[model samples]
Target: MNYSVKNILLATSFQHKISVSIFYPENSSNKSIIISSATGVLQKYYSRFASHFSSLGFTVYTFDYYGIGASNSKSIKHITANLNAWAFDQAAVIKYAKETNPEHKIILITHSIGGQLMGLNAEIKLVDSIITIASQTGYWKYFKGFSRFRMFMFWYVLIPFTTPIFGYFPAKKLGLFENIPKQVAYQWRQWGIHPNYMFGHFKNTELYFSTVSCPVLILSFPRDLFASKASVDWLASKLTHAKVDRRHLIPADLNIKDVQHFGYFKKEYQDSLWKLTETWINENS
Candidate 1:
């Protein structure tokens, strides 16, 4: 079950060089996976998950969006990476994987904002299937009770006020996430206030979703504050042409107390939730 990891720099069409890492088994196979990270999160955060899939005999790839992680060459304050630009970086990685493993069936595993921006990729049809983990629209109203209030403060009060002053989102200082580019932060803020979230801001949103016909597997955790059930449902409803399978995970089912938004990627859930993910991928692939 040994695997090898290598760091790569992918060149995007927009003249940006993105940092990417590939994890592959000692003996390769015809099935490969691309792990697209959530907004403001680095590629290294998903190293363990990529290694797990690599051990399962699938070639796995993880990359950082432009102006984040290894891809951030200059100061984020000077970068203008928006959602579309991030998608271009993602599409470049997907294209590289497709060309490198021409015989392999590529499966895209997206987390959070990764899923929301999938429609922006022009090379999306190269993907054979998609597995969205805790992916949802970012409309703040989707949250109820205290969660709604917290989101309101976060989107309305915190982001608008701080991002303008800081030139970028200093989420790292708050232990929320890696520092985000200004455009990315502003675009997210715009979505947070919109009724349809990302769909409301993305151009030709309906056409984009309609063109994605590959089978999709949506995974969500009940205790995940950000991607609530309603938000996940809203995303699923957009992909009308895709054969979608939705699964909700409860910590109790795994004999645990809590599995929050980022819990599924943690090593502790490898035996339970991770195994379930592998099983679903195997069955669907």
Candidate 2:
């Protein structure tokens, strides 16, 4: 099957324009998928994954959150946004997908923080199912050993010290994936410091998590230090009404070297790890 990609700008209710790319399959299915990116990761990073789904007849939508990637209309320092703000952007994307393809069942594929932000969207009902990849609470205690110590330094030392001087988090400068808005960096730090992560920092947000009743497929890799099994469980436990399916991907069992937090979306895993996502979506849909 053939597929075509079109890049367009989507407007959020907050007056920010998000950069979105829609992949349309030549043979369209009755389903449409929205790929929500992890924090500081660009939408382009998921192009291979989206294209694969598009080739399989699922119309896929991938977008960059405000203040990141093509959506960055101004300097990072001037772009003020936090997790909740990004949630509104995600909600808008969901609304767009539903409105544009009324006949299609909506599927949400979230990576890392993308899954947590889904809880903040009031338009949760728009989604028919969800696939969370390494999405977990940011509470530092969820990790153990060196990973736990790393989280402490990330929250207390690196983020706090760098964000102020640069007016934003220069993740790329520090050899991280991408740069981040100052507020988003600060918000992440605050959540990491809290025992309950985002919910502990913002008490009312917990109600939103409970409202997601759609079937959810949670995928966590054993080697992903950032999203340990315990961390993933913390987030899953909050989905009080959702039918949650948890799967731990052990690289050794799959005859692979590694599939850490970000490796799941890498092109190399298209036949291995990605198959799990495709199978889950088909089963749930």
Local distance difference test, per candidate? 0.87, 0.90
Candidate 1: misplaced stretches above 4 Å?
203-207
Model 1, position 76, has a per-residue lDDT of 86
What is candidate 1's TM-score against the reference? 0.96
- The clash count for each model shown is 0, 0
Q: Distance from true position, residue 258, model 1, in Å?
A: 1.8
CA RMSD, predictions in order? 1.4, 1.2
Compose the digit string of candidate 1's lDDT tens values, residues 179-229.
999888888899899997876766675336677888899988886888888
Using TM-score as the measure, the top candidate is: 2
lDDT tens readout by residue for model 2, 1-285: 499999999999878899999999999988999999998999999999999989999999999999999999999999988877899889999999999988999999999999999878888798999999999988888999888988888999999998999999999998877899999999988989999788876666544788888899998988687899999999999899999998887898998878888998888888888787888888997
Give TM-scores for every candidate, taking all chains together and pairing residue i with residue i: 0.96, 0.97
User: lDDT for model 2, on a 0 to 1 scale?
Assistant: 0.90
